[model samples]
Target: MSALPAVIDGRDKRKNPMNIFAQIRELITTTLDTMVQDGTLPDGLNFDPITAEPPRDAAHGDMATNAAMVLAKPAGMKPRDIADALAAKLTSDARITSAEVAGPGFLNLRLAPSVWQAVAKTVLDEGTAFGRGTVGNGLKVNVEYVSANPTGPLHVGHTRGAVFGDALASLLDFAGFDVTREYYINDGGAQVDVLARSVYLRYQEAHGQEVAFPDGTYPGDYLIEVGEALKAKVGDDYLDKGEQYWLEDVRTFATEKMMDLIRSDLKALGVEMDVFYSEKSLYGTGLIEAALKDLKDKGLIYEGVLEPPKGKKPEDWEPREQTLFRSTDHGDDVDRPVMKSDGGWTYFAPDIAYHYDKVQRGFDLLIDVFGADHGGYVKRMKAAVSALSDGKVPLDIKLTQLVKLFKNGEPFKMSKRAGTFVTLRDVVDQVGPDVTRFVMLTRKNDAMLDFDFDKVLEQSRENPVFYVQYAHARVASVLRKAADAGIATDDATLAAADLSLLDHDSELLLLRKLAEWPRLVETAARTNEPHRVAFYLYELAGDFHGLWNKGNEVTSLRFIQEGDPATSQAKIALARATAIVIAAGLGILGVNPAEEMR
Candidate 1:
């Protein structure tokens, strides 16, 4: 990787050089500054609201700016008056071929063909780094995901959160953030006790004793191996021991074994965590006490009685005095109890301590990826972080909706291997990791996604993963064909090609689409959504494929000219640049770009 260029005023100077939209925005701002100095506009007017982006209607122009409309009221002038003045000033630049005012005040500008040609050249120069951005500005971010209890293998619900969180982490890292991927092992909860009992039953069965798994115990066949392993280690030492004699030891052994199973499942899907913080570690340590004490110091902790929850029957409702955190002060709907009347910590207490740990680690931002069932936990968690950090650090929680599995156009059944739910391994094994990852992100994280086993594997345009991968494979084919013809297709040679030969509208449209990549990356990173990358890649692939189909009708639009290697190299450069961006976007999504259809 090349070293990033110098930083100016906390913004990377390279951002403008690689992004044409940013460059044009810079030119618009400079023109506005000149207008201010020339007394055409007021000296103190703010220009931050002005924007330069692609026109909604491509027929209007190549790019559009709302400079005239945004500045009209501030400059105390009519929009058309400002528009005409701005247009005249903008047309003076070499890159701006024409600037026309439309509607009330929008300034639609067409760029010189060389401007689009230069974008293709820049793509060849930067390779995958073309859209890499510094929007994050090196902020430290901690992303916690897949913190499911160590009871069994990760299920499909956990699978969606895992893929979303991992891709978001990679996306943030690509956007220049210092990111830490973490998982919180829920080992201190009652569920682990149930797992211990379940494994004990399996252990008894392993010892040739018939045992029945009660309703509270996990009956998954996945635990049978753990039971056999436990029996092999103990060798009938605790064969008929009482619950007190073996519960603690068996709990420890079972939790570790389940975590190993979870780790293997995650590895099969290509996920690795930087830290696995245990909930058990927060106990018997001063961490929990210290976190609550900080809240007490801030006057956000008190002994109080909360009103009975709404929709509760009067006969079943009781108000008990508890040690509660003043969550309502930080935007929660109500105060939340940290310690119950019996002096035992509630589930919320440990969570507050966990987030407190993240804040103490000096993370500038904290994000939690959770299943949709945890939606109610969002407000209280954010309230805890706000009180803990004194409003210094920010917390964002993303809830991934359920993933419904389909096969042959019907709902898929549960996996017997997992007993009641489908395991992550079950999904990954059916379609492979690349398809699983890409299809998981085809929708917004909060929206319901249907993962159809048959549809995802299809080779049609309806399958987004296949469409995008096919676009990449097509570009690879173009390069091989160019190589067979004895053409120099290296990046250096392509960058030095006579790019003016790429003046066709179809080629320019593709270049314009490529120019939006850096801007798209920054927007997606700011919103912490990696699915936008998936949507953009699909659209880009469509544009590339559309151009390829157009080539069959218009012989001049083909990537390979009959005997004109100069024009051929210019066209191939555009194709290669498109592939470079597709690979970069897929890389962010943790999907490998396909080199061939098979």
Candidate 2:
């Protein structure tokens, strides 16, 4: 049987909730309250400190709590005295079979087998909504990621950030957060000028002129099409003109085409953004000036000279009075410049404006997914958001470390189209979107990931994507076999089965793992890390595979039992629930669960 076991009728589906962990936690809380009301424990106790979580050692019990230790000092009573009284009150519940106090004051409670069986039924009834929770309480959150410069195609690094950010958004949405995915285009930067110059050379080439690409100009083949499009629109009009005549028009045109290329790449990876904000808009629309005015009104903007950065000052570094933001007052290490000595706004000016816009959008939380190279920017970015929102809005910045790609034990070559880096298209086209997304999330966002093409595709235990997909496919096979044997295996029929038939140690262990889904989802969502979902899915798959292999040698443990419909349906119910959970988890990661392994 796959991890969870399920058995429920239509009425049971509407009445019974899915989270067994929460149920047991409530039971523990209610038992503690009863003890307080009966005068066995002291009154006016703050039960907020009480916790019900699975014990580190499974043999101790299914769930353990430190209620006795937490309340002993407050109530002026010995911990063991409180624990003894609490355990006696808890064992009266039919769901909890045993409650014991161990060590000093911990209470270990073992629930009945029926409770775990009910978890399985919940999975079958709820399907993919099995692990869904409401931890966000409908708070609005803005997740900005893959805001790569509009000058070029996204490389491997941006791909990791994209996958991580997209999946994290999905996980938050599942946890009931109002999530908005955004991308900030850096079209106002100097890099777009270089892109325009590079495209100008390609435009000359399209006009049948020999133009040389200099060291500063981009020489990527991607610009060839944009240049051709430009030549087609304005043929020979600015062919020999100076930089004044065509620089602005070419910059605007090339940035738009590059953004189109980026959008196509993201579409290939199945990532969609709710908003695409432009940096160029901030410059002309008084947005940056307004943000600086807000800071100036609060005494956060001033004219000051910054000290040379500690340990690593540029050789040309010199003190100059400039428009500065007092970021140091809001936890930044030092004051940051907002405008340069030449009366032009510094890069931080637009960034502050962008965050101010996000704050003005009324989001309760803001999250930025950046590359590891932006580590130094976290402090100032947080300070900017804090000063902009006056500490009412919170900003979380997650940095995705580097991803090194390999194929057949050697480094993957760079993409010719992108000039120096491998584009996201190269990775997705080779591995497909599902494998790419799952493998990208196998490691935490801050850890360096080694993505091996040959290894990820192999159908082995070492490949987490294959391993998890295989588990789902195995359950599909079980349903097929049950149907071929003239047995009904629909979810409604399986939910009505007698789940008490599943009593083996292996089956119960799988069920316990399945029961962790809701708790895990809430924790993952709170941390803003979708990699936890991938890790949990891999572990759940391992447990399911272990049970499937055990059934080969143990006759009654098999999902199908010939000539016994009742027994077979009961065991098949467990398998069906496991598939439902695996599918649900894959959905969170933006991966499609396989129906059958090829």
Candidate 3:
């Protein structure tokens, strides 16, 4: 479950062996080139814009190309005339059953049934390699996510970002990108200072002294054990010491415990980060000074006085000279202050240094996943990245919105142990990691998700996670039945079957949906969206379920035909191919395909 897809090399465009859409696109391009060489059209025509896409209405054809409309203006001819000529050329190919010119010169193509049958065979032959794409070109990408402050346990918000970022990294890997999943620990922030004080009170209570948890302190029961552990290690050593005497040691010890708790929580949800970057390492190490020096040398840093913010100006809004970064020059709404008037760094200073370190790591692209409340940080961070990298690296910031939990159609109660927000471990313990991962990706990162506990566990069509898993399980059951009936249904045998027998419309529809996988993988990777993979798997499961239901009414539509092993072999090949795609898609989402639904 942890292994990523293999990277694909080589950029030869001579008919992709596994991608049906790319194969047809290549065929169309070659035909157009032949037309130009024969002087049927004009010379030096650009074919980059010629696209092959499925028609909005499937009744029009299996696939439709806008080659005529795209090339007509450049070739100095009417679209209909170009479409008519292209139709004649395409009709000569054995795979194309029909190529008709429709309104506005759309070239609608219907392929022979054998073309789709070949797609099923290809899926069996390639297995998980069926939808792998080479679009990323093996470029290095750094995805920083779930950098929750080391103050307490992770809530539901951080859980969503963790799932989304991990899936997106896997999706990018599937598309051939070398991805590094990273987490930047905010251990140097003021929040960690608060955490040290909170643990100090707990440590006092461990020594049989009653301590009151005031408004600014964390009161969760999780820290009670940390207090007891501190008492066990060094009893009363810093009981009455001054703040400076114990602040550093307490902060270091508390931050380590909190990070250990976070790691355990993330592991419960099946997340493993490759790197955990500490913010405290940036201070007194010349990193922040070096980053600011880089900006100062570029003439992007200056002393300035900022005007009061809109709608919320401070009562004492006196103007003071502060060191600011010229974020406006890099497309921010306003310049941002990096150093305060007191000669100390603001919060933005450390963030700028962090991104500068990432840029120096030689990554081609950077992606930051933050919670929705950090919406204001998006522009400033992007501007900093653009300025720091000199516009050489692209940064994409994904903000995951809130998650509302439900159980039995009612809002879930907060964990007593967590005291405020529900802990990620609470959710994972209630429902396993597979359901959590799948439901988290059912919506885009920007959209809110309502995670219904009971619905996800229900064995019905309305539950997409259950529905998809059932489809794969159903295929397993069918294979078992075929084996019991003394039929050889291995991949080698299925691949060599006479797939020409699979000409029914229901069978061909399943093949068409399977053909869209490679294209879908490339599109999802290009857009940095992993939700598309979940959606595709749900739709594919529906197509497979529909074909399975059709067998109830049509005797010939059943996958295991009685007294006809040849027909059964052809039909079972489609079923096996569908399962292979479902398994591959679930793998990208970091979920193991369920062999049985219980």
Among these predictions, the greatest TM-score belongs to: 1
Order of the predicted models by TM-score, top scorer first: 1, 3, 2
Query: What's the ranking of the predictions by lDDT, best on top?
Result: 1, 3, 2
Model 2 Cα shift for residue 478 (angstroms) = 1.2
User: Candidate 1 regions off by >4 Å?
Assistant: 1-16, 314-316, 413-420
Q: What is the C-alpha lDDT profile of model 3 across 151-249, one tens digit per residue?
A: 888888899999999999999988878899999999887888888888999999999999998877788888998888787877999798787978888
> For all the candidates, what are their Cα RMSDs to the real structure?
3.5, 5.2, 3.5
Cα deviation at 60, candidate 1, in Å, is: 1.4
Q: Estimate each model's TM-score.
A: 0.96, 0.95, 0.95
Q: Which ten residues in a row have the lowest lDDT in candidate 1?
A: 1-10
For each candidate, the alpha-carbon lDDT, in order, equals: 0.90, 0.88, 0.89
Whole-model alpha-carbon lDDT for candidate 3: 0.89
Which one wins on lDDT? 1
**Local error of candidate 2 at 188, Å?**
1.0
Q: What TM-score quantifies how close candidate 3 is to the native fold?
A: 0.95
List runs of model 2 lying over 4 Å from the truth. Answer: 1-17, 412-420
